[model samples]
Target: MTPGPAGTTVPAAPDAPALLRGSGLRVTDQRVAVLEVLRGAPHADADDVVRAVRERLGRVSVQAVYDVLAALGRARLVRRIEPAGSPARFELRVGDNHHHLVCRACGEVRDVDCAVGAAPCLVPGASGGPVDGFVVDEAEVIYWGTCAACAATPALLATAPDA
Candidate 1:
């Protein structure tokens, strides 16, 4: 187990190469490094992944990191979430019907398990005038508000203007 944030001990990350192979992807240094970065830092943007991968494997290209992310996403090894007014972030946690809590003040994101019921938590009622005939496989829920830290600091509670 490795020490996670806030003195919590979390299981060590799975082997990156093994994960790539299991996902039917060719194992490469760049791929491994990208996976490692996501494991360490969840909700990282593509630019964040590129910087971390380059730090580990010197001289890596931005396109290469993007390609690795695309491959991982296709294999369902990683999930991408796009918060409004924020860059798309990637996380290694996939498959589960989880949601996210996004902080409007700091843009901090944390996982929130399925809210009330089973997979695809909220279902469209028969009153589905707009969603008629639409099959809902998954529901993307993002609760936007100030995080605890930001709430404690009133100065940080002000929402920034959308860019």
Candidate 2:
């Protein structure tokens, strides 16, 4: 299903008691509210998250949002990413070895599956002096480009003779 505009009301936050019991979270109004915000606005920055949560739970403090984000990120429930020149953002997609494509002009992010279907892209150029045995869990690859929206802009196209 498509997401709504910022601050748009979605379903009420998931059942607090059941969610907490399943995930082992403490189950507070703030935590549920924070998760709901992330669910609606994946890759939202801290400030945006605060705004969204406040819209749902009126009077939610910025500090409360920060704390909840920290807790969720630590538990691997949320994925936190900070692309260069952009504020850190949080999303609910986790566990999969997904890469990202960040729009250089707009800083928008979208997930991409493993380069060839599974783990490890190209083998590391050099294994930092070969340790005894280090297992590689996941590999992250980011593709930077001008998104369709940015590429379609006349000003941007005019600047690039190649395009």
Candidate 3:
């Protein structure tokens, strides 16, 4: 596991085409390129993905990239996470109850392990919150804070008060 920007460890990205095949997704150039981009740069938005894919594969369209993302998302090969006030980002981390820490200052995102217990976080205190819930199965938690890089800069601190 490679340590991400924030202490969250990022799982090594699996082989491009192989991963797609495992997900039962038709292995295509665009699909491979999109996965490669996300593997190298997790939490990338659609625009960032489009630029990277085009860099690797001559030309690609925004709509096409979105289509690939949609396919990957449906196959559970990729995950779409939308942080409020920010564009939805994509990552390869799936089939787990991992969380994320989004930098409020610069929108940097990092993967975080399940806060308490195992997947789903169904047990009380397992989610770092009140245990009372109606058949909890998945936990989507985002810890918003100033990333180290932004905190050091000081000038870019978000104007919005800390939550």
Say which candidate scores most in TM-score: 1
Q: List lDDT for all candidates, in order.
A: 0.83, 0.73, 0.85
Q: Which regions of candidate 1 deviate over 4 angstroms?
A: 1-12, 127-131
lDDT of 2 by residue, 1-163 (tens): 2233332223334554565557778888888887777876777999999998888889988888999899888887778888777898997767666677887766778876667755665445377332456666677677888778878896875664334
TM-score of each prediction = 0.86, 0.77, 0.84
What does candidate 1 score on TM? 0.86
lDDT of 3 by residue, 1-163 (tens): 6676556666776699999889888899999999999988889999999999999998888999999999999998899999989999999888788988888878888888898888775454655564565566688999898877888886787463452
Q: In model 3, which runs have C-alpha deviations exceeding 4 angstroms?
A: 1-5, 122-134, 158-163
lDDT value for candidate 3? 0.85
Q: For residues 1-163, what per-residue lDDT tens digits would candidate 1 score against the true structure? A: 5664544334466799999989889999999999999998989999999999888989988998988899999999989999988999999877666788888888998877788888778777766333767778788999887778988886676554421
C-alpha RMSD (angstroms) for model 1: 3.6
Runs off by more than 4 Å, candidate 2 = 1-19, 120-132, 156-163
